[model samples]
Target chain A: MMNEQRREFIKKTALGVFVGLGAASGLVPAFSLEKTALPVWDEKPVPGKIRWGMLIDTRKCKEGCQQCVAACHHEHNVPAFKNRREEIRWIWKNSYKNVFPTADNAGASKEIQSRTFLSLCNHCADSPCTQICPTGATFKRWDGIVEIDYHRCIGCRFCMPACPYGSLSFNWQDPRTAIVDPVTAYPTREQGVVEKCNFCSDRLIKGLQPACVEVCPEQALVFGDLNDPASDIRVLLESNVTMQRKPELGTKPSVFYII
Target chain B: MKSRKLLWLVTFAAISLFAAFYLFSNGEAETPQKPLARVSVVDSTKCIAPKEFMRANHMQVLHGWERSVVRDGDRVHIASNGSRFQKSLGTCLGCHNNRLFCFSCHSYANVKPKCWNCHLSPMETQ
Candidate 1:
């Protein structure tokens, strides 16, 4: 009888101790016995199920129009440098010859030769940048978007050269000094970290499209889940003759150019 | 015997002088007043957690939030009070907009955090 009473006492004491610890650790509400509601702002990126991709219709992109570039830079607080050598860009226009050297033809029409293509991070499936990062700072997200964790990047510049697209930029000096009308929404990067287009992961979580896609005057850019058959990007990809940059390299870029 | 007595006398005198110097000199020097952190403009009760908990584990909380929001893309933080907040420094600065509050406490503690190096502090906006 005494042993039974002792067992009951011990079980109750253990339960009380667990509850106390939980309350102290802020895992459980102290006064309120009600369960806390889990407020989800957006859907979590599930690996392989949802792959975010982009389709850029280069034919629709107008010449000398940098609205998308300007919007991306401003939205991300990318510093402007007058010196071309020191300039940083998340997205910029490059000549077709430079962007797609393998596909370029000298005998092509002047319109095709001089045509500019919007260039940014390809966010490759088998990305060399993510593979070469020594610190694992550059990584492919579960949603197929490649991104860098600024906190983990050691400024080794390995990812910069590993990325064949030249999407990454290093902060040589204090970026804040060069920023004009700084956007408080995004944190400015410190010197010595490599930063690139995050596909606006911050905005994506808030249920907003990428800044470049949203600001495109001609609606040349389309962003949607590549894995979803019903997604707009998938429909565009199916209907158009899209080309990935340096397909020979087997990067399998998510950003496709509808030439 | 006389030499030993002389040595003891000298030792006693030195001890007496040292004790007197320490006690008197300490009282003569005025201790600088430590700057107190100003209370945040918002009600203290509105904090995500209790005042004592936040005061002790704010850094841990912030670091956890940073990792989850940036790396894992978990943006929503559910507070113990069932209030949801976006896991960003902007959310904190929205209410505690006073720069003096942060600086005063940090200066007093002699801890210089590099959060403001990249993040836009309330000081910069003001």
Candidate 2:
């Protein structure tokens, strides 16, 4: 009986060691190693995986409404300089004729000629600004958004003229001095860098919509993933006729307007 | 000839004594006292990392964070204890809000970081 008891104890000890080894090796799901992974700001943006685009319904957009421009400027801490040459603007309005010069304009209405259109960075897929930027400061993000790393910009105006749309502005003087009311959420650009709309990439990372889109009372602006067929912007594109600024330039602009 | 040799030796000895006196007097001159680096924490709480680690390598951590936040677009930094913090100078200023917290050490070390050129410091905000 003592001999049997010794044999039983040996069997139990061997089984216990086997279980411990299995746990250590992660063979058992409950014993898997727990890693403290960082809270990622979305997955690393992959090219063509998500193309963030915007659709603006020009019909609903009011003529005198500066809410979108105000909201964008305030959120980005874009200063308003007294000199027009030294002024910085992210988003602004322009006459339809100026915005869409290539579009058929022979029989356009009087109101159409006078109508103002929202103008900002096109965030083009084949952007000339990104191509001409000597420093990799201004480039297209993997998700199809054009962004500028102000820290990397060398104040070269190569991107300014390369862009068909006058979307970029240079900070000739200290922008902080001109800021009427500064917003601490975003940083202001230094005196010697080109600034423009970033499509609010900062907000997108925080799971918030763009400031302009959120503040528009008319809901005229629609932003979504262009790659997703089920996205609201895509649905709007499918149901309505849309126009892109300077489509002939082959920039492949992501911003669409429903006239 | 012996008298001339003695006169030359006397001249050399006089020059040597003057040079030694100048050197010793310069060495005894008092140097200006070094400015003391004093940091007062506005919010005294547990830091993201150990005090020793932060004191030794805070610059490295900030630079690593700058690259991650600006270039890679990874804004969240998870501490060893699993607490999440935004990877910005603002986060550091949130706790060490005293005006001299950064400047005191930076001035003491004679370093001039250009972080405030673009980013607003607590002093500017106030």
lDDT of each: 0.76, 0.76
Q: Write the per-residue lDDT of candidate 1 for residues A1-259, one digit (tens) a residue.
A: 6435644554677744432332234232222111222223433434555678999999999999999999999989999977887788899999988898877476557887789998999999888898789878998776778989988899999988888899999998888899997777788888888888999886776557999999998999999888777789989889988888889987889999977
* DockQ, prediction 2: 0.05
Encode model 2's per-residue lDDT on B1-126: one tens digit a residue. Answer: 999999999999999999878644422122232222222212223467887799789889998987776666666666898666666666676565555566544653468877777776655664
The sequence of per-residue lDDT tens digits that candidate 2 reaches over residues A122-237 is 99988889878988899777667898988889998899999999899999988999988876667888989999999998777656789999999999999988877788999999
Residue B83, candidate 1: C-alpha displacement in angstroms: 2.9
True contacts kept of each: 0.15, 0.11
Number of the top TM-score candidate: 1
Clashes of each: 0, 0
The residue pairs that clash in candidate 2, if any, are none
For every model in order, the TM-score on chain A comes to 0.82, 0.83
Model 2 chain A worst lDDT window (10 residues): A28-37
* DockQ score for model 1: 0.06
